[model samples]
Target: MVDADASPPQAGEPISEQEALRRLRQSEDSSQQYYGAWWLGRMRSQHPEAVPLLQQALRQRRPRDSGDGVEENAVARNAARALGKLAPAAQTAIPDLLDTLQDADDGLREAAARALGQLAASEAIEALCEKLASGPAGAGAQQANSPRLVEPCEALLEALGDIGVNEPRVLAVVKPFLEHERPLIRSAAARTLLQLSGEARWGELLVDLLDHPQLQVRRAALMDLGAAGWRPGFQAIAATLAENSLKLMALRGLVEQGNGDPGDEALLACMDALL
Candidate 1:
């Protein structure tokens, strides 16, 4: 069990906001871990200085030594989680949050990426799309190469979908995932694309997914289309709702999207049949 009152800062020597901020800026992972804990503790305080310190900590870049030299920093991850707890008023953190997607440390990169999604900032759409287009490494050469980076990239893609911002660049970034070797990556990309694109594009893209050998991939694509709320996607959902194998998933998407009104009676009927 953790002691809540253990190690409370001594009076007068209580950790200064500047020291916390400086420690957060350290590029060393060890320093980040130390300061990250300090920042988390500070967040619970009602001190007038707390908010700005938290905001700065969130903006601080993560240590660079971890694998996937871009966006994988532990410091960045802790900062993002902290910022999410301070959200709404933490809107000012959005730009920094978006910038974090480009971090060299995959952990930090993904953390920032995920935090932005939680914030759901419309302003981040363009930048997210831009990052997706260039890939997580940004426009420069990538130093770290590892399979671990894919997970963060996948998480970033999912966040983009949840945020629901549409941009042609984002579509282009998502389009290639339909054929990715990793089913999870394919599923995330397909879902994000379905949310950001219209029916025509979704229908065309989903057709490709329907033929995919992986059952999970096919189901994910169908589910994405059904819940996408575009006319073309609705039509695709209607057509697939009769297939015994795909029907349940298609209907599930519709119900989840709250498209069960009188206007969607046909969809609801189809969903009932599937269930």
Candidate 2:
């Protein structure tokens, strides 16, 4: 729901709010239902029935094939995602989303975790912590000591980070992921720890990731640092191999987090250099 660059659903032409709701409920076309749910969230529809309708969709268990049998994405995934965009209003969805955390489908679990995070459901903190109990990944372990749900675990880390929980358990659950085999997950851990602890070591780990062999990892590091609002990450972000525009975007985020100080001319100089 909070994805900065996620494209709108391409199901079909736009329709009136009533039409969208009608399709979601009474229409025979399931794809139309999916699009309707997406539209409601994209527009943040204020209709009283919007939240309830989406919740029903989230509870639905149907295979989503794109008119072809080749793909198997679930309709419920999008429904859950839409609810995240309509949070507080969607507070009724907390228990349902929690149940989804244990759902068999990895995609569903990932979407639910992301939604719970966007809603800032503090009640979800304990439930999310359980998924991360992978026995910890030490710098020497080379991999997680216990197996973890690959993408789902990463999504869980991202959710906890976004929730901005300051409890010791939140920090404890995430710190071990610094040694995760994947760079994005490692940086995600660093991002959360940096935000929660304000520790330079975590930021330094993110800085180290700027030079990772994988280009995607480098980009993830840039955005993670920006989201953490660590002012000192500017130089490393500017030096990363991502597109010029993203580098500037990252620098702009750091500037917002930077405290006003005429003495911090060097930071301003870096922003000027990016220009």
Candidate 3:
């Protein structure tokens, strides 16, 4: 029943509410459906009516009898992401979004978690906690794996952090993952822990990550510590103060910690050298 323009809107073109609504009905092509959902999410602030349409898209299932291979799940997933972009305004969709978190599709689950986070859906915190504990829904190798299974897990953890559920119980739930073999997951856990507890223990854990061989892991830790005003890692962060790509984050961390050498002198000298 959904319908939209057969052709997509021109790039950089500002689509009106009517046009976006039209796009959401583009059921013929999954790609068109995706674009419609994406644009609707992007422009959701201007058109609150698009929210229910997006939820409808999320509810659609793949046509089993369709000879043409349409990615119905993908369209639905995009719908979920668009709802996430709609964010706190999309709070009315939380029940559906939370249900999507348990979807068989890992990517869809991630999108749902992100949407809940944006809404700051505290009602979903316990569910998010359980998702982190349970890992992704799968059989065989996925159950025992760490690095191989990253999507929804990382997404869920990041969502929990964004939702600001930093309580002792939540910290307890997130702590064990600090030792995860995969640096990416470890970084995610570290970031979440920092957001929740900001305890010296988590700070020290992040400090150690500065030496991580994976640049992404190190960057994640540095960014979190810097933004949180975590001072425990100042020395470790200082070591990277001159490295390219990481220096600015390092400086941010140091500046936030109030560890600057009493004025614009030392920090400016370092900046000049780095630049």
Which numbered prediction scores highest in TM-score against the true structure?
A: 2
Q: What residue pairs clash in candidate 2, if any at all?
A: none
TM agreement with the true structure for every prediction: 0.54, 0.81, 0.72
| Location of the lowest summed lDDT over 10 successive residues in candidate 1 | 1-10
- lDDT string for model 2 (3-112, tens) is 53234557477689998788778536677787787778778888889888888878775444447763333457777888888877998898889988877666788888
Better structure of 1 and 2 per lDDT: 2
lDDT of each: 0.58, 0.75, 0.67
- In terms of lDDT, the poorest run of 10 residues in model 2 is 135-144
Error of 2 at 219 (Å): 1.0
**Candidate 3 C-alpha lDDT tens digits along 67-148:** 6564468778778777877866687899998888777666677778877877878988898887666443321114454434
Those runs of model 3 whose alpha carbons end farther than 4 Å from true positions after fitting are 1-17, 61-70, 134-147, 222-275
Query: What is the descending lDDT order?
Result: 2, 3, 1
